[model samples]
Target: MENTVLIKNATVLPFTRQANGSLNLEPQIADVLIEGDRIAQVAPAIESAPPSASVIDAANHLLIPGFVNAHAHSMEILEKGNHEASPLELWMLYTYPPLQSQHLDARLCYLRTLIGAMEMVKYGGTTIQDDLLELPYVTPEIFDAVAQAYVDVGMRVSLSLHTINQPLHHTVPYLSDFLPADVKQDLEAAQGLSDDAWVDLFRQVYQKWQGYRGLVTTVLAPSASQRVTPDLMHRIATLSEEYDVPIHTHLLETKTQAITGPELYGESVVAYAKRHGILTHRTAIAHGVWLSTQDIELIAEAGATVIHNVVSNHRLCSGIAPIRELMDAGVNIALGSDGMSSNDSFNLFDVIKAAGLVHSAMDTSYDRYPKAADILKWATYGGARSALLHNEIGAIAPGMKADLVLYDLNTLSFTPRYQLPIHLVYAENGSSIRKVFINGQLVVDQGRVLTVNEADIVAELQDRLPEYAVHRKQILQQAERIRPAVEKMLSTAVSQSLSIHRFSRPLHYVS
Candidate 1:
């Protein structure tokens, strides 16, 4: 007999929008049947359940498909609140250097990944696309540690070994000058090391972890167009094709890349990717904030997905992505919280609210932004599509993976609620997530994580915080000391730079 579970008497939010330009929010008390790891049935009020079935009463709760975080850096959770006042460029100097240098060890890396996954799961995110960029120091043990954490917590993960081949001399502004001339030359010569290293590393990781009980999978992550060469991009694309895995990358994230791509590569960054045949259905690009109209068109035509980290982009002042334009151009747009260090939170509801508000403010039209249902789709189906898991995950339909979140409507924020979807998007937060189920397993029940002891995890992090802080302070001091030189270098190199720019395009009111 198959293991069976039933969730009964819940308000089912199927994330399916109706043709009437309104959410399909009709309240129906239903029973969801889960057989093993998949949703077996969704019916309106089943009278009786099998004797072997475990029944969960989801009274006064909204049952929805679990959220999909399409792009993130889970390893940076420890660096949160370090660079709040810093802009993108300065933040990179002060904040990222510490992560790249001191905190790149195996223990801390796994701990951070665990904590990040904990935070995400607590907030109802079932699938996470983690762009693991600290690959230079990663090991199989570290990857296994992180993967085990995800499995223990009952969350799905698409893990990637992020690789960047650009020389430190070309990438870091002031740090290059600080190095001895000979050392700088040697570092420049090591530009291609990241590609070869990551190819081998990920090949090993994928072979070990790709189908590990269907809980973990691996992807090839070339950091970005500017950070990778054409040859490396082609190799990544080919490897993704060969293994039938997904490819994740950053694209047109900053104005600097958009403006400098023509000078460096004789074409726009999107054009460069296209020339190398890197854009495809299995590709998911994070933060297309500076992508032009033509770039958006090309990406849509290529059937690629873009993840919009609205809060993170706003916090870093990285400029707003043309989400309306991208959606209008038929680009699949998903929601991501980015790294906790940049966004300062791992809550997808916060991102959903921020996405709706930001786009509305930009377009000066209420209808131009995503509606409550649209945001729901972005967080669920759109996210699954971004990670190339649409067929297996995202929806709460029969045959889909049993990844579901139950949000309580009894909270103060959701009082007097007439609309379930709107309240979920605008009012809900981590505290409202009462239960979380991943792949037919109850990982979090009654607002507590069932896999690991929360107190012990917190205690461990508290014990390690001071050591991380010391290293963080040292790196920040170094960045501050070299700030003037970096600014000078940036000023001399880039003629036109915008600190905070906004772009707007008319969205066809989709109902």
Candidate 2:
């Protein structure tokens, strides 16, 4: 028998756009009827509920589509708050290098991925574009485990085989010149998977797992131009075409990255992407913080998505993405939590709040500012576009997949609320989450995940933390050894004058 859920008397956000370009709610209390995994009806009373359907009384609740974390890294949940830095290279060196040495098995991979998925779903995230990179490299077992964990958690995930083709020393510009002989040797000697090896890995994972149960999908992530070769980027582009799946790439997240395209390809990253045939409707540009005006135009023309990780950007001091300009250029803007290592939580509610507020300070034009509903759009529909699943999810409508978030109207965030959409964007936190339905499954009920024993997951993971701490301490010690060189490189890179300015951090700060 097909499972059905009848949610009763819920005020919902239809995410409808007004003529003045602001967002408004549907202005109706409606019942959402779900049959199997699809929304059967959304109307007044929903009178045709089947006898076998489970009824959920959702009175005094706000039902909206679950938010999509368009770009995220799965493994970073284990390394949360281990290191903090404001610049990209320094952030990577301090935060990521330690994990590269931590040997991981399938179980660890599953746990790492589960924690991330659990966090996302717990905080109103239903779908995510997971850029899952195994530390050092990806193995077939590790890859499958990550994807399976998402399904086991009942979350929709587009998992990417995240790897870079470029050597470590070459990935970063001018860093090799700044390092000591031994340090440079260590970095230069660091090898990643070859083109053929990566392709084989992709084929292995793809053949086994993609499009799993229609909840799991696959994306080919070439990491970035700074970390990926042109040939690999082209290959990934081809795969995206062949599979009809979106491709995600980190583009111009930092000033140093913004410098790479000009230094190496004699153009901007957007132009370089165009040259490599990577600029497409299927391409998702993660952290396009340093893109130029021309770059934005090209991306809009190509119909690519620009994923905004506002919390991640602020944490790494990566600067504000030109979201207003991009939106004006008709570029699809999506939101992400990045990874717990940088953003510290997969709670995209926080990300949604950050996205709504961060851009108000970036530009002077009040009219161009992203309204609260705009942020919701980015969180929902824009995110669906990031994974090329716009038609199926991202909205609460009949005939669509039943992925919905029920927020308690009694929460403080909605207290004395005059407007629904505005209050949701500005004031609400995760406390408002009453229940979450994904693909017609009650994955979260009464604000608790039902797929797995979260406490047991936590307990089991906690049992392993003592041994992991030894690795954590050792990696922290290792990070200190290379901090001086990394800081020097950062200083050198910061000293040069650029054609433009992205970093709002003044050249000097006053006490």
Could you say which candidate leads in lDDT?
A: 2
Top model number, TM-score = 2
Q: TM-scores for all candidates?
A: 0.90, 0.95
Clashing pairs in 2: none
List, in order, the clash count of every candidate structure: 1, 0
Candidate 2 per-residue C-alpha lDDT over 1-511 given as tens digits, one digit per residue, 9 for 90 to 100: 8889999999988654457644456557989999988889988787788888899888898899999999888878888876574676766755567235545668877887888888888889999899987656777888888888999999999998888655555765666766678766665556667789988888787888877877988888877766777887788888878878777889989877777777767887778777787889999999999888898989999999999999998888788888888988878899998988789899888898888887888768888888877888888888998898888898777778989999989878899968887887878777889899888899998878999989988888888777777766776776666677667766666666676677676442111
Question: Candidate 2: lDDT of 171?
Answer: 66
TM-score of 2: 0.95
lDDT values for all models:
0.77, 0.81
In angstroms, how far off is 407's CA in candidate 2?
Answer: 1.6
Instruction: Assess candidate 1 and give its lDDT.
Output: 0.77
